[model samples]
Target: MTRFSLNQWTTRHWPMPDLLAGCAAAGVDVGLWREPVAEYGLTRTAKLVQEHGLTVTSLCRAGFFQRPDALEDNRRAIEETAALGAPVLCLVSGGLPEGSRDVDGARSRVADLLAELAPYAGEHGVQLALEPLHPMYCSDRCVVSTLAQALDMAAPFSPTQVGVMVDTYHLWWDPAVWDGIARAGAEDRIALFQVADWVTPLPEGVLTGRGMLGDGCVELRRFREAVDATGYTGPIEVEIFNDELWAMPGPAALDLALSRFAQHVV
Candidate 1:
């Protein structure tokens, strides 16, 4: 059976305890998040997750190499992810810093940061999953904006040390998406498989406004077929960041998302 998980961003309006409870009530098996855990405190959040038997699928973030001062922060994020018992830590390469328009330079900085963080993450049994944001977000969100680019950066690290996060919402429109998935699997580099629909006329950059499953133009099954062909049997995590969805009760949104995921992504 395909396992279903929710991204914390989708339930940002709800408190962590309520979110976990709602996920359990909705029958979701796993969950992902960014820094909200720290706000709620790791020990308390971990206990809440345990109480509901929810799997912390992966931490939402742990990378922002654009700044010269990012190394320490990245390391701390890796340590926190390990403490959460998350098998994977998702990394967003971050945007250009002030007075820097060089995308290549940003990429280089990110590569350097990853090289420094990989060994530490490996020691903690946490895999760093570099998430390539959609090209639309290249300016303010992430410089690593494609699976091909992410794979190139990941080439030097082992799958356990570094890997790729294949988010359908980010990569669905890429012409090389399937090929990238194949290559990631061939190299054993796929660390996570995130799902969400792509709605047109995106309001802002790519952060929020993601569509619910089956609500947009993404070809979900094709993505599943590609991942399955690569021998990846991990949970298919649903990571929508829709504002409207967040306003509703967590259980209602989770139930609807799960139904859409089964009908569209399975």
Candidate 2:
């Protein structure tokens, strides 16, 4: 059976210690965010995970090629992931820089930035996992918004050092998603798999409007089956970003996530 994990953003406001304790108690692996890990102190956070016998599935993100300090920041992120014993560092390539509408140029920067970081990440035994956010975020958040695009961006690098992330919430609407997953599998580029359902009437920014599993139209189990068919044996991370979920008590949210994950994903 495929294993299930929870991304920390699903309960964004949850305190780190409490969240870690909850996941340990529930025997669930967790996807961590850089901010909280930094705020809580990197060494402390790693020790906490070790003490609880918890697994850090992957670090949230470390990409924004447009930023002047992007490379340095990513180097720190790579070190952090190594400290946490996480194998993947998710990358959300930033959109076209201010006043720039050249999408192709921005994507080229993504590839170039990966070339610089891939070797460093590999040195640390971490994979740079490029995540394609929803196209709605193409303008300001992530320029890479499709599995194909992410895979292509990761193509030139070694698969062990650079790979694509498959998040159901982002790729659910694409008709070619199944084929994309197959290509990712065949290319050995699936660095991570995230689960989130789709919901309409998106909020002003559409950042936190993800639907809980089974509450929307996504064929969650089908996506899970597709990923499994690819021979991936890693954690299936639930990463809902709905406001309601973030408002619940962390434990309550976690319990609900576990139940929904069992029902709709695996």
Candidate 3:
């Protein structure tokens, strides 16, 4: 029986205290986020999680490696993740910085940064999970936009220090997606598995318009089966960024997510 968690993006309008309470009310055991915890102060946020008994699945992000000035920023991200007691810290190798069009250069910089931070993350018992964003976001979002690419980038580091996140919304269209999932699991490199549906013609490519589970065409069960085949039984985290959902109340949005997770993902 796999557990289900909700990403904070689903309830971004709610305060940290309310988010934790909402997750608890919905019977969600895990929560994921990017910089929200730090913005709210780790001590206060961690205390809230303790009071509500919620698990921090993975910090939403920690990488923007394309920037030349990213080394110190990456170090601080690792430190913050450790302080939050998050088992995994997600990374999105940023797009090319201004005045640059070299994708390979950006990737190389990401590799270098990962090499520098891997030991520190391992020492703190936090795994770095690289998330592959959709290709449409190639220019402004993550450079590693495919499961294969993310796995390749993470190959040099030990699984304890660097791993990959398999988000169905970003990867369901890849021809080699199943293979990548298998490889990640075979190598024990899948740090987290996130779920969301892919809607065509994204509005802005930055935020909003993520479909709910079973609302789009992604083969959710097939993905779950594939991941399960690889012997990866971690929680299946639901992450949706939709304007419609955001407009609704937090509890309503969470109820829909949980029901859909039960109906479509099992």
TM-score, one value per model:
0.95, 0.98, 0.95
Question: Whose lDDT is greatest here?
Answer: 2
lDDT digits (tens) for residues 1-266 of candidate 1: 24788888877777788888877877676655656888899888878888887778888786877866689888887787877778998899898887778988888888888888999999999999999998887887799999998999999998898999999999998998989999999999999999999887777655677999999999998998899899998888888888889889877887788788889988
For model 2, the stretches where C-alpha displacement exceeds 4 angstroms are none
lDDT for 63 in candidate 3 is 89
Residue 123's lDDT in candidate 3 = 88
Clashing pairs in 2: none
TM-score of 1: 0.95
Rank list by lDDT: 2, 1, 3
Candidate 2 positional error at 132, Å: 1.1
Worst 10 residues of 2 by lDDT: 1-10
For every candidate in turn, the CA RMSD to the true structure comes to 1.4, 1.0, 1.5
Identify the candidate with maximal TM-score.
2
lDDT of 3 by residue, 75-141 (tens): 7777777776778888888888887888888888888889999999988899999889989778887
